[model samples]
Target: MQYRHLTAYALLSLSIGLSACSTAPLNLPAPHATETQSLLHLEDQFHLNNLATHFPDPLAITPEMKAFVKQHVPESLPEVGRLRYLTEALRNPRTFGISYHSGLTLTAAETFEQKHGNCISLTVLFIALAKEAKLNAWVNEVVENQDQELLADNRIAVYKHINAVVQLPNKQVVVDFSDLGDAYLRPQQRIPETRAAAQYYSNRGVDMLGENQLGLAYQYFKRALQLDTGTSYIWGNLGTLLNRMELYTEAEIAFREAYSLDNNDHTALGNLERLYLNSGKKSEAKQIRQVIVRRQLNNPYWHYGIAKQAFEEGKTEDALRSALRAIRLDNSEYRFYYFAAQIYRELGDRDNYHKFGIKAAMMRKAAQDAE
Candidate 1:
């Protein structure tokens, strides 16, 4: 395997929507006076500007729908006097063709009322309800190729499931009606203090980056930070992007922010150290090295950090040793073998270099095999 060029330019051309909203359950602020006014304006403009689009044709309430309302709609309101209801009553089931691109068509609210919708419909319902309740929400689309066992057949399918976050008066809640099982009013679960939304964007950005779409990845990382500034991973990733762009000052600031958010983050610390060293800020680099030494006494990623720093500084032997230790602890990481091979090449150790090169190739092949 050759030294993979992780260029920032690759992420530049991918186009993604910036204004997409979240539908996951989370505490969100109600639309303020200004936001409400803006939303109303947009809604009016949507009707006036898009005259060709048709409104939902209201159908007569069927006996099943009426029964569903009676059984599912809560008789009493909550203490806050909020009357929570699905968008529309249940409808007759229709067999959708596999060609139906469900997600591209439905809104979150529509999915909620329909009671039995595809992934896209459910997502649409989640977003619609959040907006109707005047809460802030957004949408995240995850893309991957995996196999699913359906009943008796094992088939390869691409699934797009939509889950939402609702910002209640106090806390954020995740609403997933995809597995509601015949029940219409089941409550969703609350995500622990984890940065799910941030991680979602970060992971997307990483994928785009891998595909050589740097500009799009940068936008994703920026959006991730906007959603959860406390996420150290996004901050560190942003710093790495800045570094790739050779914007040293901006990269330093991002690394500092990441370190401030989580001092123990090895990625941030290592990147910061590398930045200081490259810029000839020896004193700062030394200080960072001291911090790394102190933390490495107990941390898992310490050797990985040390290996990366050594490789960057042209310390081939040290880099090779530290990278080998890291690989020993976690052989699944391709970075370990990749960097170790580079070090072996630098030291003119052709045999060892080819060995590590083969290891890196095997690791990548294994990942693709598992997928």
Candidate 2:
């Protein structure tokens, strides 16, 4: 999960939790429920007697899942053939043919039975099946280093994609069930199975919170923090829930914990700012707003959005300036180059237009070929 400016809207991450498993067997580490710090007073406040104890394991392989793999991936086939057949069967319309939806975060078994789920559910299912086939599989957080759309409720949904990766002796295959292709974020972060399971719980908490199931949401968030105490987004999510429950003191702590874990992800900071404002701490809120502005100024995607808007408004010079700034900040995205080419074309600078256009086309082709 990633964070963005919070004043404009609440920021939430829709991360799919795909945990890692070794080739020998799927012996994922158990959650360190005792060491968690984010959910300090919430257990007593919400009367969470069992807390993280009773929730079903999101990655538990059901009989149906095992049966599907056994029938489609024959033991007679070589390792490579088995892997190929498994992937094909998962994607084949005549087989599992899992589809995408942004609803509940389901377990691997539930995803298989339902045949539809969001990215998180799909990736979870993939890792579970890969484990059943005795393959090295894990979850990776693919950061696009980009901003996402704002929902109707004025929430900023900055999505960090989750995908399953299967490793072989000489090669690694990323089964990007999200279908993001090669145009994914760079510098992937591998999640431990325990933390990945925490992501599942956190995602489910988000879903429950959406449906106004506050008590259940609290339970899910508690389980998530217990599993992985380190994730800032989960902390931030719990903070959001706490704030909703009017547990302001604990909410403050959770938000602070989140910010301390990852200052780069500004969700905590944004929430903090809101909390300050609500408590009549205008000076603190002002200071946080300044910090947010400074961070936004440094973001290349923010500048790119500005450039696009300027171009649409026919402010050619202004668009060019912002586009160039965006390129200077990050030269990896092809869309920036393509936009620069358009600006140059509008300015009648034929040589530079062709230069940027060619560069954009080459970059785009390279990305596709890499896939």
Candidate 3:
């Protein structure tokens, strides 16, 4: 399984978008002049040390990295040719292929040694190699179609799939390390190296958060915000950390800031809803949930989840309704059609069952062919 997939009870959930203009119970200001000061104060107040200097540089081209690049990328080749050679060399199992490793985010050098890293480490390694090879390559953020899974702690782990891009005069070459097909990946924008580095820090923060290292996670999130304050996910992660520490007011402010940056960030919206519910603001929580439902009406995965749950509970009619809605939202997902077939089978609708069953099979085959 090169690409992550959802089994039963799985929510093929996309990030829910809430209206940024929606009225909120909290009077939070947009990030402004005092933003840096507030961030610094948080660091000072927590008595945390600035450890960015000690962290490994994800894009640093080590001696071994340089040697690998020199051996693979020919100096005589044109820029495009060199890029092609380097990409091919990296993916060739005989040369240097990196296996997909979740949760472990390594630097370029570490990834080279271990031959295993998540998407972030792989992207960093590619950028490093491209730098040594003198190719114009950098990290491109995939804005839409983010892959996510539910963690054991009931937190959603959103996979921010990033890949490297080489811009040529005629065509652009994308170096994707993941097995996700074109249907699942669409590069939105090219981010600067600093933001890419911030991603490394944020990933570490998430790892620390998962391991219950509160202090360490705080520092990492702070470091990430210091590097790139525009990224909503980092702010949302900081909010999560603060919420865990019982800093409700600060967490609410952080979550609001995250929502302000990206109105479509469902995670931030969901976090805000949770905070509201925990604080016993039932009215506010209900309002936020309504907004989430309105936004998620366009998300097929949410409907699929409802369908799956209803089916498991023996409500075949309700399951069929949600399943059909899922298909209407996104017919490309074979799982939706497959689930619909199951519902139809349970209802004794043999004709529709066979119809959906055939469609599911065809969709699956088409998806495989695209890959």
Candidate 4:
């Protein structure tokens, strides 16, 4: 099962829970008991107690995708000159989000034929074409002001709008959808100081860390901290690197800084506790865990992480219990069901195995449909 599919399963389960709840009391047990039991049954049937089982390894891009990218290569390079063309394309009244949405809905060939798309679609197109042209280009996930306004409706809805940035001989230029106006377009603005920039660098650091280039990744995270000192994410990244490097003292400091910035950053707290324990400071680790327990009373991810750790260490019963707690807190996270499914499969529970399998399959299908 794919991670996306697992996510879909979680979402479907949540949807069912939300829609099924009505003001009228069912002819069941107490209201709270009925709700709790119903959710638990749904979780068991779907194997939501185990998340790791549902996530398949990431797949390689298809040959067809590569061929499509090569065939419809853009004529212009993704440099400063391309900004003018992008602005001019945006001027057409029809070339708004709707147009871009259509382009993204279709394949690369279809989008190339249209020659116009929305900010996101255009950014994708630009990145694809730039890659084909062998130009240094990447899609920057920025939180725009428009995205901030949209968040009033949903906080978890990350404003993942894409924009293009080109590295010129002299300077870099930002080709953003929002910057496209009627009059002569202005020069690309200087890189601003924001939490988003911190996130951007932290993500780069993560990528580097994945490649095992810890030193480079640490530098990127440092740069991220310089850009936005208030961001807890950078501190988290820094702590992760320090831990990997076995710089226990520095790692603890970084984790503490992250916790100071956002007490809700469980990763930092967990890392700090781990570091304290490794350093033989068992009392300090216990104290930190106590603090974490007080703050993370209602946090599902904390429970999920603990469950995952237990599962990995061959403690099936403990893993199952922890996962169940996590699922009870937030049934919408697909990983919970995925993990539960794995545990059931291990215990030879065929009925539950199939139930969670179907749930995961359905969720994966939904995600593919959305894409």
Q: What stretches of model 1 exceed 4 Å from their correct place?
A: 1-194, 300-371
Tens-digit lDDT string for candidate 2 (226-262): 7887877788888888898888767777777776677
lDDT of 3 at 61: 77
**Which should have the higher TM-score, number 1 or number 3?**
3
Candidate 3 lDDT at 131 equals 84
How many clashes show up per model? 39, 1, 0, 11
lDDT of 1 by residue, 1-371 (tens): 00000011111111111132323322112223342222212223113444332223111234443444455444464412222443222222332111122223332233334453444444444354334434455443322111111101111111323345555576544444344221112222333212444444555566656676666556667666666766555766766666776767666676666666655554566677778878998877666666555545333244666666667777877877777887887777665687789888888999989999998888777765653
List per-prediction Cα lDDT, in the order shown: 0.48, 0.71, 0.72, 0.48
Q: Which stretches of candidate 4 lie over 4 Å from their true place?
A: 1-220, 237-256, 271-287, 294-298, 362-371
* TM-score (C-alpha) between model 3 and the true structure: 0.78
Candidate 4 local lDDT, 8-38, one digit each (tens): 0000000001112112211111123232123
lDDT for position 134 in model 4 = 57
Q: Which of the two candidates, 1 or 4, achieves a greater lDDT against the reference?
A: 4
Q: Which residue pairs collide in model 3, if any?
A: none
Write the residue-wise lDDT of candidate 3 on 120-198 in tens digits: 8888888888889888888877664332222111246555667778878787777766665552334358889899888
Show where candidate 3 strays beyond 4 Å.
1-37, 49-53, 145-154, 183-187, 305-321, 330-371
Give the better candidate number (2 or 3) by lDDT.
Answer: 3
The TM-score measured for candidate 1 stands at: 0.35
Cα RMSD, each candidate: 17.4, 9.7, 5.6, 19.6
Best by TM-score: 2
TM-score of each: 0.35, 0.79, 0.78, 0.41
